[model samples]
Target chain A: MVHLSGIKAQNLTEKGVKTRMKILETAEQLIGEKGYYETSIAEITVKANIAQGTFYIYFSSKKAVFDELVYQLSSDFRYHIKIAMEKEDTFEAKQRAGFLAFFEWVTKHRNLYSIVQQAVVVDEKLYRAYYQKIAAGFITSIGKAMEAGECKSLNVETVAYCFMGVGQFIGMRWVVWRDQLVPNDVFEEAMEILFNGLTHKGGKKNWRISRTGYTNEQ
Target chain B: MVHLSGIKAQNLTEKGVKTRMKILETAEQLIGEKGYYETSIAEITVKANIAQGTFYIYFSSKKAVFDELVYQLSSDFRYHIKIAMEKEDTFEAKQRAGFLAFFEWVTKHRNLYSIVQQAVVVDEKLYRAYYQKIAAGFITSIGKAMEAGECKSLNVETVAYCFMGVGQFIGMRWVVWRDQLVPNDVFEEAMEILFNGLTHKGGKKNWRISRTGYTNEQ
Candidate 1:
């Protein structure tokens, strides 16, 4: 396989890099509006103010541009996740905080999130790549927490998948197809239940306090 | 539009119903052995010991039978869910029971589950029909629960979508692409976390301990 990272290093100058970002950003926005199948390279070129051939020069096809857009978005998603994890104190708080940060980023990059969501169900290569790229990091974080006796000691992969299952659902429901925002606290509360359990375990621990700063009653 | 349900209503002969069931069963088995795209009307007819003309007489085209199959599957899924809910004691238990039952059925019917999952993501009209059909019932349930004050009042549409979203990712991760079976308890635990959340002062109250008698704590 021709490595894309290598191609980017060789083919792109700083100017080319800027153009590529613009193209990807534009493609992401258009895909959000028209979906993956409806959006075309011509529209992307027109929107990016570049030649159709130039679009090809940077990426092989519309799918390639899409893959790259997801690649960039996921990396950025990880960066933001890391940032939140660092800022928080405990591992549990970090997981919750990182998820909230990731959710917020997805809210901002609604377009990218929609495109990736569609890709997960639509294409085989995209589905496998998405799973490979996103799942490992998630499993590792949860695994580390389990190992350190911070989180529940369940099978890490299953728990990781459980978290992802819930996260993707939230992104689709609250971010893409909805009219209003689901409050951040609501999301945090949900995460608390997911990671912790719903009952009053006598640990006023590991959950978001409601808007009134009152923890939910048993 | 031509209606298969109408034909079923019209058929009074014992032979007619038996033949119809035979054809459907053969088609279902063949679909598992061979994929939807690869399985043809001719092959299905031959396998069922029916004539080619008879096949078309039963269903209009390839797409129609596929649609009917999925429609039936969706109906069955909803039926199982209703049964689960009706049997459960508490509201939270009802949701958990319903979800576990649904997921368990999907697990048992892996090939059928995959066929339906692919229909939603790969085919446009099929996807819409599948989504809308399932969404309608879920919307009603959420609306009822919200009105009854059984749960937190939230946007019914977004909440329904969110619920489906969780199912989608988990289905793909654990059921479709999964190399090994992720056990029922893992999914049960996930659902518990999803329904009640960890941060609530009432810790275990939101969860319905499964028939397995294990807490999803691990």
Candidate 2:
């Protein structure tokens, strides 16, 4: 058994990167289905059709691949957002578009999203990496909107963090935890509540982007 | 030991519900320091200076005590909020006072808050019970406010759930995750933003009281 395992490890190393990708993809799907703690290295290797010993050659531990997966997933999310933004012109559209797209993506891939969440509680390394990737794109765009005078200029970083926190909080509350979302119109209502706020009286005499990207009061 | 445990369980049940409260209190303080997972029945017994058998008399499992502790803590939270409102007459003052008292209480004893957060990720029983306690007082207040026309006629339950999620998320992000927070003013700023929101012109808005006890918004 040991000799066969050794040969399998060498074959995996010879196969190179695809072996690693296969392991990661297998881990992602497995963790998504059975959770991180429940799924073992042996399970991942068997599912990936690699030898048990071959798993450690590509990644250090269960946690490392989880971190890499989150990083890659976040990158994909940001790429999608960038592509979506490029497809639209105005800043307002981008803001609304960003949230709508995020909500849809998260809902459609609920399993993956839950895996990221489960990773957070299971390990500390995954938690930090998770938070970093969790809302970085949304945070960056909020800063850009401030610079472009599309949104109010306050502490851009704080607003970004606040929005990310609130958005996820609402998503977790509605979709993940309770599932009482108002069908298709939830995001529209959310965006309306978020952008216009509960108090905004449409577009007149309310706060808007300035040429200087900041209000005169400051 | 089994005989002693059985006798103790019988004695505890034979007496009244007061023993349960004592066990929960010690569990709360210990679990706060040791955390939910790290905490055990032995630790609680040691802290309470009770026998290991006595610990099992009131609680079934370590998780059971943790869940019950959360329920009791939120009950105390609501009771405190009720008391704070009694001291303050204005709707604005009452709301701010309620949140202020809440922040102070939660920040002072973040261990319990951390445990509740752990429940969000770990245990299902603790999760639902935690949110239920959270929803109760918040929903009641929102319902009262709406009936009095102090705010929009929105779903109080949804708003309550959202507020609970948002408040806990920020508290976890700022207090638990960050090792340090500068200037107490940030919390005040946070509360202001939460209530009045960023859309409102900057600068602190002091909470004001209405002439009547009910409300005046629609």
Candidate 3:
């Protein structure tokens, strides 16, 4: 049986499992196309070809289904990245694989961005948990790499957030917005900045204090 | 005269300007507090202490006001970053100042994240325009720095997006989420990764190909 948080899925029969998945998938499509407030439970039921009563059998309320959709999408993408990263030996390769996996997965689930973004207001805690969960995975991998001297020693949390930001914006720009795979050169350039710093070796010593009083380098 | 896009603000008297500002401010607060769909025009006018007719004098519809709020906020934050970046001499210093300015600005307008995220559903094009405008600013600054040999030469657009992602995530994590100024150590560490890159100097040569076939380094 497929496990879903906060839902009793273990006792679900094979047909019951399919019904629940249908409900979630239908929610993803309707909520993704229409803003959460604009989509009605009745609309979801109609599109899913399930009775209104059947919908209630799976989800108690619209918010409940939305929360589950966000949770499921988050888990799905993280699982993809994990599997991709597992095939790599080096930290850098692992990161690259993870990014590639993310882009590929998002391409298939284009509504992932809209559904997730709506969570900011739909349920602020759920939105935070979505990113925090992803960031936690990054923190663990980066922390291990740092301990092994495979990467620079910085605040793992900060670096994890940075990694998350890069992956998200790149995916949003190329995959979700343009409906295309991230171009090879663009992917390479992002990795270039990720694996190596942006400053040319010769320019590394040029850090300076600005008039605003913030130090540019440690 | 305070300039506003899509609104004829220059012709307004001082009172007209104030009323218009009031409407936008009220919208920001309401839309930021409650999701856009939940906030009504009547509630906005009531909170702004203006009559329903007075609200229509400034904005034609709820979406019009919401769009204007997003435009104004985007312009405001970009202006802050621009002024901050202008105070620095080196590329690194300028970037640091820009980030500091962003965090400071977000602290004041804690709703910026929610308001912008809502734009994804309220108006997709506005959402894209918001990030594109910021990226354009980064691209211009980073392009000039690259030509002057202040930073490494890479895809300027990709680097621009990277810079934006770093600033945004750092701000979202610290200023917006924590409701505290980004701690000094965290700020410095993010700047370190942004300017120098995440991999250590010694690990620069450790790039390798994984089973997934993506290159880790250029």
Best by DockQ: 3
lDDT of 3 by residue, B117-171 (tens): 9888889999999999999999999999999998888999899888888888988
lDDT of 2 by residue, A114-199 (tens): 56656445565565566665556656776787777766666554555555655665566565565543233444434334444433
> What TM-score, computed on C-alpha atoms, does each candidate reach?
0.66, 0.70, 0.93
For model 3, what is the error of residue A3's alpha carbon versus the real structure, in angstroms, after optimal superposition? 8.6
Q: Name the weakest run of 10 consecutive residues (lDDT summed) in model 1 chain A.
A: A207-216
Q: What would the TM-score be for candidate 2 when compared with the true structure?
A: 0.70
Clashing pairs in 3: A197-B196, A197-B197
Off by over 4 Å in 2: A1-39, A43-50, A111-129, A132-139, A178-185, A199-218, B1-50, B85-93, B178-218
Candidate 3 residue-wise lDDT, A142-167, digit = tens: 99999999898889999998888888
Q: Tell me the DockQ of each model, to 2 decimals.
A: 0.18, 0.11, 0.62
Better of 1 and 3 by TM-score: 3
Docking class of 2: incorrect
Q: Rank the candidates by TM-score, best first.
A: 3, 2, 1
User: Could you tell me which 10 consecutive residues in candidate 3 chain B have the lowest summed lDDT?
Assistant: B209-218
Candidate 1, Cα interface RMSD: 11.9
lDDT of 1 by residue, A85-168 (tens): 776565566666666666667767866555665564345567568766678988887777777776656666666766776676
Tens-digit lDDT track for model 1 on B1-218? Answer: 11134456475466765566666666666654454555788988998899998877668876677777776667677787898677655555566556655666666566564456445333546755777788898788768776777656655665565567667667666665763344556665555455544232333322221111111111
Model 3 CA deviation exceeding 4 Å by range: A1-7, A202-218, B1-7, B203-218
